[model samples]
Target: MIATVVGVGLIGGSLAISLKEKGVANWIIGVDHSQENLAKAQELKIIDEGSTLEDALQRSQLIILAIPVDAMLKALPSILDKIQPHHVIMDVGSTKEKLLQLVAGHPKRGRFVAAHPMAGTEYSGPEAAVRNLFVQKTMVLCDVKNSDEDALELIESMVDKLNMRLVYMNAEEHDLHTAYVSHISHITSFALALTVLEKEKEQGRIFELASGGFESTVRLAKSSPDMWVPIFKHNRSNVLDVLDEHIHQLQQMRELLAQEDYDTFYKLIQKSNKIRKILK
Candidate 1:
């Protein structure tokens, strides 16, 4: 298969690498607004060539949109406008509801598949791309009923080639669940990082005192704003809902600590540890 990756950033570059390595895509043509990113992806051998979206669309059988949510919203309709029946388009955006809605009535909607590979690091750019990043990860397909069976199957086959697990959900359900699981975590990490930075006047002291847990908790704060801001923008209500609950939980803990209620505080932590059952 010939695949054209639209972003050439972390997700796109990594997908390009995996598809080539696993023999799923015989050649990868990259499309990105950033010339430097395109050049870097080529230099890293993440893509065989770089071209405009129009040119890549004409040449490739599969088009992967790994751009930010905002860009995807703007680009999706036009891309759908250009797709032929033989071409399959897929997106790896973090949020889905708004995107799916935007392209809902498009004539070529059947040619598009909404997919989110639930795997990534707190990194971006072509250099951040890693092989096998999606291996064993969950790939959520939102609103598959709206997609053509052949388009859906092509993406499912690609997911299989990448050694990923498949999950199906409607766009609304997918957005809501991601807000709870993924979006909230990044927001919490960013907030935690800010709290530590505000309290620790000296950066050197933070580096000296940081442990593995602290490092891991703050890692998502290092993620690019270019990617996350649009996600928060598109999924504003869901994120705000989760954030409100999170703040309430923090306040509850603070009040317990203030009252010197050690027993209750301990119980709260024990309750939190129940996440182990789900995660493990």
Candidate 2:
């Protein structure tokens, strides 16, 4: 397959590498607004060539948009406007609802497939790309019924080549669930990192005493705001709902601690530990 990945950042670069390594794409043409990123991707052999969006679209059969959610909303319609019936367009953005709605009524809607690969690291750019990043990960296809059967099957086959598990969901359900599982975690991590930074200003010994648990909990805070801010913006209401409940839980724990209610706090901790059953 001739593939073109727009953005050439972490997700796009990683996809380019995996597709080449697994023989999924015979050639990869990269498209990015950043010249430096395009250069880096080419230097790393992540993409065979770099071209403008219009030129790349004309040359490729499979077109993947791995840009931020906001950019995807703007670019999807235009790309769909230009694609021929034989071209298949797919997006690997974090959120789905808005992008799906933006192109819902386009005449070429069936040529597009909405996908979210539930895999990534707290990193960005071409240098952060890695091979086999999608292996054993879940690829959620939202609103598949809106896509042509051949388009859907092409993506499913690509997902299978990447060794990922496939699941389906409507855009609304995917947005709500991801807000709870994915979005909230990043917000909590950012908050935790800020809290620790505030303490570090008063005491330089803060990070010196940090441990793995602290590192792991705050790791998502290192993620790029350029990528996450748009996500929070697009999924505003859902994120706000989750944040409210999170704050309430923290308030409950604080009140328990203030009152010296060790018994109830112990039960709360025990109850939270039940997450192991679901995660494991």
Candidate 3:
């Protein structure tokens, strides 16, 4: 089937590459507003052809929107006008609630499949595409019971090619869980990076003292502020709720240390260590 990927950045380019490499799509078309990205996507051989917004919808059986969260607010509405009954539209944006709300009453809503592939790297643009990106990932499909049978089948088939599991959730549930698991991780990474940079002040000292733990914790700080700013803004309530909890926990640790509550601090660390088994 012909697949058209919008934005053609890290997620879109990687998806196009995966589809082409796995023989998942009969043809892969790419659409990006940035000419530089379009060129990079083409140079990387991520798509079989470059497509227009209208052209991609008319010609493609599957369309993937892998753009920024804010851009999706405007883009998804336009898709409602162009999508055919046979076409399937899936967005890989981090947050879903607002965008889903925008299209909730659309005539072609059933043709659009809201999906979030639980995979990414702290990079952007077409050049950041990687062959191993989607392997062994969990792809959450939100409110898919409303999607057309054929449209849903196409998405399921493509996720299968990536060896990713398909998970079903509503828009609310997806955003809430992702806030706790995925979004919070990014915020923590950003804060940790800022904290270290503030403390070290010297870039040389930062590089000299950096270890595996620092690298692991600060990795997501490399993610684009352009992309994340809107995400945090749009999901403000949930993000702030989680951030408050995180800050409270941090304060509690500091208080324990100040009071010399060694036993309580040890128990807290032990409880946090339980995640090792769960994450493993």
Candidate 4:
């Protein structure tokens, strides 16, 4: 099988490499608007060949759009014209609600499968991509009912090649769970960064605190703002709703601290500590 992957950034580059490694694609063609990325992808052997969108689309039977949500919306209409009924198209964008709505009425909507593989790193560009990025990850297939039989089968086959688990949900449920699990984690990370940076600046006496928990929680703060800003914007209502509840919980914790409530604080820590067992 020949596959064309657009927006050869981290996700696209990673996918191209994995497909080649798994022997899922006989020829993996990369398409990116950036000349630098194309050069890097070629140098790194992430793709068999790099070409313009038109050239790649015309030759390949499978298309993968790993671009940002906004860019995905802009590029999708042009995609519709080139995509054939037998060809399967998939995206690895973070948010799904808006993308689903935008393409819902397209006559060839079934040819496109909405996919979000819950895998990534705090890095970008073709150079940042690594093999096995999607290995054993949960790859969510949204609104599978809306995708064509061939498209769905092809998409699932690719996931199997990557050793990914297939999970299904509608776009609405995807957004809701993503907001609670994924989106809120970003907010927590950003707030933690702000908290640390502000403390390092204003509190000179607080420098002695060195802990693993702090390092672990703040690691995700290093993520790219370019990727996050749009996600927060597109999933604003859900993200903000979860964030409000999170802040409320923090404020409640602060009140307990102010009152010298050790019992309440211990219970609070124990309740949150249960997450370790839940995660395990």
Candidate 5:
């Protein structure tokens, strides 16, 4: 298959590499708003060539949009408008509810598959693209019932060939769950990074003592605002809901610490350790 990967950044470039290496695509065409990204992707051999979306769509059998949610919202309908019956379009946006709703009633809706590959890192650009990023990661397919059978099957087979795990959910469910599992983590990391930076001004050696735990906790803060702001905007309600619960937990812990309630604080830490069972 010839695949056109729109956005040509970390996710798109990485997927393009994997597709060719794993034999999912015979040729990959990269489409990006930034010509510099296209040039870099070509130099890295992440894409076979770079072209405008319109021209690439004409020759590609599969189209994968790995752009931010905001751009995906703007582009999906038009791409669907131009899609041929043989074309299958998939999106790897973080939040799904709004994007899925926008295209819900489109005449060519069946040609698109809503997907979020639960993978990435605190990086961006074509240079950050790495092969096998999706390997063993979860690929969530949202609202598959609305997609044409062949379209859904094509994405499923591609996910399998990439050695990813498959998950199914409706749009709303996907957004809500991801807000809890993914969005909240980034927001917390951003907040923690701010907290430390603010403190570092007063204590210049603050970061000198930073360790693995602190590094891992604040790593997502380095993620691109270009990508996450739109996610928080689109998944606002779900993110706010999770933030409320997260704040409540933080308050409970704070109250315990302030009152010197070591017993309850101990219990709170013990309770939080339950996450290790699930994660490990």
Candidate 6:
């Protein structure tokens, strides 16, 4: 089978590599707004070739939309407009609510499947693409009931072949849960990075004094704003809810520290340690 990857960025390039490795697609064609990205993907051997969306759609059996959620919203309907009965389109966008709603009742909705692969790194572009990026990662399929059985089955099979865990959820639940688990992490990281940059005026001191914990906590700050801004915009309500709680928790900690209530501050940290069992 020939597969077309529309973004040719980190997620798309990585998926292209995995598809060929797992024998899901014998040939992979890439389509992207940037000819440079397409060329880079080809040079990296991440794609067999790069083609326009129209040409790629004509020749490919599977289309993977790995672009940002906003781009997905604009491109999806047109892609669906051109899909043949044999074609199945899947998206790996972070937020789902808006995109799902946009195509909810379209005539060719059944040909498209809504998916969010819960995997990535604090990186982008074809050079950041790595092999086995999706292995053992969760792939959330939203609103599967709206998709045709064949389309859903094909994606499920591909996910299985990719060695990923499959999860099912509605659009609302997907967006809300991801806000708590995924979106909040990036926002916090970005904020923490900004805080450090602002407080530590001596720039070189940051590099000299940064520890493993600090590095890990701020790593997501390196993520592309182009990718994250759309996610935050689409999942605005859920993100705001999580941010409210996060700010409340921070306020409690600040109050405890300011009041010199060491006992209570220690207890707060101990309570937070409950996450150890869940994570480990």
lDDT of 5 by residue, 145-227 (tens): 99999999999999999999999999999999999899999999999999988866855475678789988999999999999
TM-score of each: 0.99, 0.98, 0.97, 0.95, 0.98, 0.99
Per-residue lDDT over 95-162 for candidate 3, one digit per residue giving the tens place of the 0 to 100 score: 98998888988889888889999999999998999997999999999988878788888889889988
Ranked by lDDT, the better of candidates 2 and 4 is 2
Off by over 4 Å in 4: 202-211
lDDT of 4 by residue, 9-93 (tens): 8899999999989989989998888888888898999988889888887789999998888888888877986777777889999
Off by over 4 Å in 2: 202-204
Compare candidates 4 and 6 on TM-score and give the better one.
6
TM accuracy, model 3? 0.97
Which is the better candidate, 5 or 6, if ranked by lDDT? 6
* lDDT digits (tens) for residues 1-280 of candidate 1: 8999999999999999999999989999999999999999999999999999889988899999999999999999998988889999999999999999888899999999999999999999999999889999999999999999999999999999899999999999999999999999999999999998899899998899899999998999999999999999999999999999999999999999999999999999999999999993
Worst 10 residues of 3 by lDDT: 79-88
- Compose the digit string of candidate 6's lDDT tens values, residues 178-278: 99999999999999999988998998988998889998999999999999999999999999999999999999999999999999999999999999998
lDDT of 2 by residue, 1-280 (tens): 8999998998999999999988889999999999999999999999999999889888899999999999899899988989999999999998999998888899999999999999999999999999989999999999999999999999999999999999999999999999999999999999999998886685557557778998899999999999999999999999999999999999999999999999999999999999999993
Q: Give residue 20's lDDT in candidate 6 (0 to 100).
A: 99
Number of the candidate with higher lDDT, 1 or 3:
1
Per lDDT, the best of the predicted structures is 6
C-alpha root-mean-square deviation, each candidate: 0.7, 0.9, 1.1, 2.0, 1.0, 0.7
Question: 48 in model 6: Cα distance from truth in Å?
Answer: 0.3
